[model samples]
Target: MQDWWNAFMPYPDVDVGHASTGPLSGLRLAVKDLFDVAGYPTSAGNAAVLAASGIKTATAPLVQALLDAGAFFAGKTNTDELAYSLIGGNVHFGMPRNPRDPDLIPGGSSSGSAVAVAAGLADLGLGTDTSGSIRLPAAINGLIGWRPTHGSLDNRALRPLAPSFDVPGFMTSSLEPMAAVMSAVGMPATNDRPISILIPEDIFETIDGVIADEMIASLRSSAMPIRKINSIASFSLADLAVAFTTILQKEAWESNKTLFEQSPDAIAPDIAARLRAGSRLDDEAMREADRIAALFSREVNRLLCENMVVALPTLAMNPPRRYAGPDSFAAFRSACIKLLCLSGLSGCPQLAFPIVSRAGNVSLSLVGARSADRMLVNVARRLSTCLKEQMPF
Candidate 1:
């Protein structure tokens, strides 16, 4: 049977045997094409680029760690062209179907990875979260998506996309596999403990009213005291978005300028346009972005000091329709960036949990201080338990 999900790479499946015994033994794993797999070409979802780039000589250390810990490698999965867009529709490889809602888009560039896990095709899907790539898809597809603190996971042998913001992340059907995968990858072990929840009034307001209310209600159900803060220090969502976009564009241009110049016509028009814009950014603009980003990071770290977690909607609204027009997608993308850019700019750890609202399936996100990746997962697990007991909330 042909898989309508269209999650895996078009090539034949690559099977790396699972360990006889370990934490993840018997677990199925699928990787985004951006991660090198020894001899396979790291396509990054662009056919021409794949044709131009030769096979990788080494496997990414993160993928290797999972295999060593007993996870079976399934195969490479599709991704947005060059891992650039968040919409998930690759002009070349086609978008992965949203297991929860086929009509809605499967948020990307990590689109296939999330779908693979959501559809039960893979127990764990390894992806890269540059700015909500993992979190957005996880939320849209009703799964748990986690983006660790910048540089927390090894990145060697992975394609670069806004290096400063790009971090290894994953999507899983449930928290147990996510926790297990994190443990295998050398994530510091953390004890399960209750943490304080902070609701950033400004960020939550960015989400649609119905979705925001649903998320807030979930937080209320938790015994953790929820504090309403006026702002994340002085930084607004818009400010963070601008700073993050500027830096990302500048860095992306630097990383892929050569590819753009070599085969401009081979890339998708939307992605090509973004690269062109990035090429036009000046050093002064990047410097200003850096200054703003540093300030935002410092403020976020201060606010999230140990034991504090901030909750907000993962995306401003639900995922855009699969065939949404360019103009409609542009507006949706802009609003989403405003919320997602917070973590990218601040370099904090974030986890998105699937939550339903009147509008439809939405995701609630929790942001924590640097090095709090494990803590965020633990908190999500505990909260899941609480929500289950108080079912039909």
Candidate 2:
């Protein structure tokens, strides 16, 4: 029989051919393809990118940290090509089936990382969420995925799409390992007062009905009640979507322009088209996007200050089906990318807890102020406990 994981499958045999062990001995890890892992090819879910870039010699610091913790390297997982899209399908590597419902998407660019953890294939998996890539998949796959504030986790030896937004993140089936991974990576846990959660209805609009209902029920049952932020003005998610897309495409184009120029034929057609679009962006548009990003960041900080954490649906819609046609794929793919940016724009820490399953899927996300990652992880730990007790997960 053919292997179910296909090209998306990671190398499971990892002993590193060495005799070193430490605290996290026997634990398994799946590193996203975007992160350099000594011998594995950084495919970034595209054959062309891998062929052009070749194997990376160094391991990311986060990966090294895990190894120091005594975790065995499982292998590299799939990602959205160039870490650009959120939908999991790679035109090159076949998309991994979501463990919840293979008919639906697994969510991306951290697609394989989420699937690996959700399916119990790995104890922990590294995933990069440029735009909800980490949290969205965790929500869809019933895993705990955390993104630390920018720079809280190092990004060295990793590929970049938007340097400002991209950060190394990880996913696990439970909060315990998630916390352990974060702590081992050097994020200090700080105890806080009572937990305060902010619920912004406008953004919550993008959440599916089943998840919204479950979250509301969860809030009502919790010892701490959630507060609605009334003073915050709503920016058009659509407009923000446009701005976010334009800025990222432009930035990605600039960052990878050299590669594109050297071998335009090497880049995938869809990605090449996106780079062409980014090329059209003038300095003025880029500057305007910067202005908007700054403004939005300030407002987001204020909303998060009122509460220790802000809660939102990790993905706007249920995991979409794997589209067969290019047009259908592009449309579904774009929406997922835009929604992923909500947390990405903040550059803050996010902890995605698997609170409840709806329609055989999961939904849970915790957004925190920048540099308050440890506290956010604690909040997720408590929430996960309450969920397990109430929902019997």
Candidate 3:
């Protein structure tokens, strides 16, 4: 089907069957291009990869589980090249239309998946989150997005970007469907009612002044008690971003190097530059970046252990316009990465729930500790008067 939004990858009648009875009964599921599904090509959003692939022999175990749980396959959605950038436009397959605003970019890697759900083409969107793929788009498009704690869900049969950071995640238009998916996957529920909300002073400081003021004001209006504290050991956002990019470059290059090696011309110019950046990093730099990342993970996880959820703007700014200039996009990405790297490095469960204001469509993300995925979902459900009204769920 040629969707108006270009959310799905073109395929020849890619069919999926599901159980008659299960928690996910009759739910429409949109699969990201990265996952292997029987009877369809697994392109991973790169034309070279698409050209090299054939119909997969076996469905990914994760997709199988969802199918068994009774979710019907909607279609495979578009993604960024090899699932790399945060903003959506793919060089080969055109960018997925953002249901929120046509001109605004749907957040990337998981862009098409998010668009699928937001545009009412699917009940749930299956995507992966290494950095902000799921959460970022969910925020921009006003959908509920969950990046499960790393390793809490199956990652097998999905294309690897950074193995240590890659995790299977999903997007949905609302809460009940998300809860059903969680139940189908057997994610245990948590009683961790958030006792406090941690507002990292440094994160807000990095945002543009108007957006910062609006976010803080919005949070203050919430019923949950908020605590402002200095964090990251005096490390600037650039430091944390550097830590994430350095490690991702190394791991991503290693995971997909063979593809690049075989089809040297397949890599997009931007993606190639990122891969080269990683390729040139010396072994020692990778190790040092890893060390810093581990420390940050521990620090963030420690806060979560106390039943405190970290709350911040999901993306540092509103989504950039489509086909933005490279220099401008690069600068924009650098700022956004700092906010995204928090959950990426920690491997914690971060959920983005939309909260639209007169200013624009913005979102507040609540991050829980590892394995606290269900808790954040529950927290979203318990949103106070103001937040509840803004929630699509």
Candidate 4:
């Protein structure tokens, strides 16, 4: 019963000396290890990286924003090695146990961030979602995780994985706190337009039956009208994965080449393998990946039009069982990333809120327009309010 991810730093005293105190003052907040918090070493779940890269001397912009917003920080949480894997397991820091069911694996690379929130250890937790890092864990843990549009938040001090898609996100048990954190972190929080929830026929079909039903029922009860829309004409998920990998690899290779070349033996095995994989992607393939990304972005925008938020299951499958076999891992990872990329491609905002439980598992997901993050927040808030009212004893 020992908490492997327990906070080394106790909750901060917000009222004594901090901005925006008394409101979010005592609220507990946890940051992913990738973010630089002034005096802390950004371990990024790797001992080698911590030793190799010098200690961060200043707080990251996002960290500063959270602190300024009156959040009582609970210290850094665990992450996947170099924030690369969707699964949270690390050879170094043991896997963070899922709060809902200890028998299952907590989704990652934003592993501990979501668990911290789900376990009620923190009011809000910060995580980075490049693929399904934030949303997948949020889905599994039954929490609300919001990944804003690309470039919506500053990435000045965050360690990069896939720079193009590595947007910082937040996890909380409810949409109110998630929206509050986003607003505090500088995302617009309110909108005046009537909300439109778009259900993508192709992507929704991929979700497990029970989870999808819960999500759909929640949407139906909302004050807004739900529309059936198809964005991004049918495309191979495998192709998207190849493109995402090529781009991440090319960027990672360029970013870590010096350190990797200098002390190739010092890096973690998983991270090393990932970097090596990136190195293997051909230049032509990388270019093709970029082309596909651009093509998809345009198509997605056209499909969304305006004032319409796309909705889909946060994860295509259920939480992975702890120590799942290699084949299970592959299948779980594939489903998780495939659904997430729909939003990642267009750089749209996504707000994953857990609606209900089925067979002892939580059902969850997000809906939002590209760059229209404020509208999405408003929509989520309204949806959560409606669901609470409709709940029967």
How good is model 4 by TM-score?
0.90
TM-score of each: 0.96, 0.90, 0.95, 0.90
Compared with the true structure, all predictions reach lDDT values of 0.85, 0.73, 0.84, 0.75
User: Whose lDDT is higher: candidate 2's or candidate 3's?
Assistant: 3
lDDT of 3 by residue, 1-393 (tens): 448999999887755788888888879999999999988989999988888888888899999999999889998999999999888888799889888898888888899999999999999999999878898888888998899988988877898999978988989988889888988897887885547777888888877778777777767766778788886444667888898989888999998889878886888889988887878899899888889888888777666788888888888866678777887677767778888888888888898887666677677788887877887877777663566565454
Predicted candidate 1 versus true structure: per-residue lDDT over 1-393, tens digit per residue: 256799998776555555778999989888999998975778889888788768677788899989889988888998999999888899888999988889989889899998998888899999999978898888888989999889889999888989989999989988889889888888887656667889888887776776677678877887767888888868667777888999888888888898888888888898888888899998898898999999888988888886799988888866679988998778878889998888898899899987544565567788998888889888887777776666564
Q: Pick out the ten consecutive residues of candidate 1 with the lowest summed lDDT.
A: 354-363
The weakest ten consecutive residues by lDDT in model 3 span 384-393
Query: Relative to the unseen true structure, what is the C-alpha lDDT of residue 48 in candidate 4, on a scale of 0 to 100?
Result: 74
Worst 10 residues of 2 by lDDT: 10-19
Q: Is candidate 1 or candidate 2 better by lDDT?
A: 1
State the RMSD for candidate 3: 2.2
Give the clashing residue pairs of candidate 4, or none.
Answer: none
- Candidate 1: where are CA atoms >4 Å away? 192-194, 356-360
RMSD of 2: 2.8
Model 1, global lDDT? 0.85
Worst 10 residues of 4 by lDDT: 7-16
| lDDT (Cα, 0-100) at 379 in candidate 4 | 71
Candidate rank order under lDDT: 1, 3, 4, 2
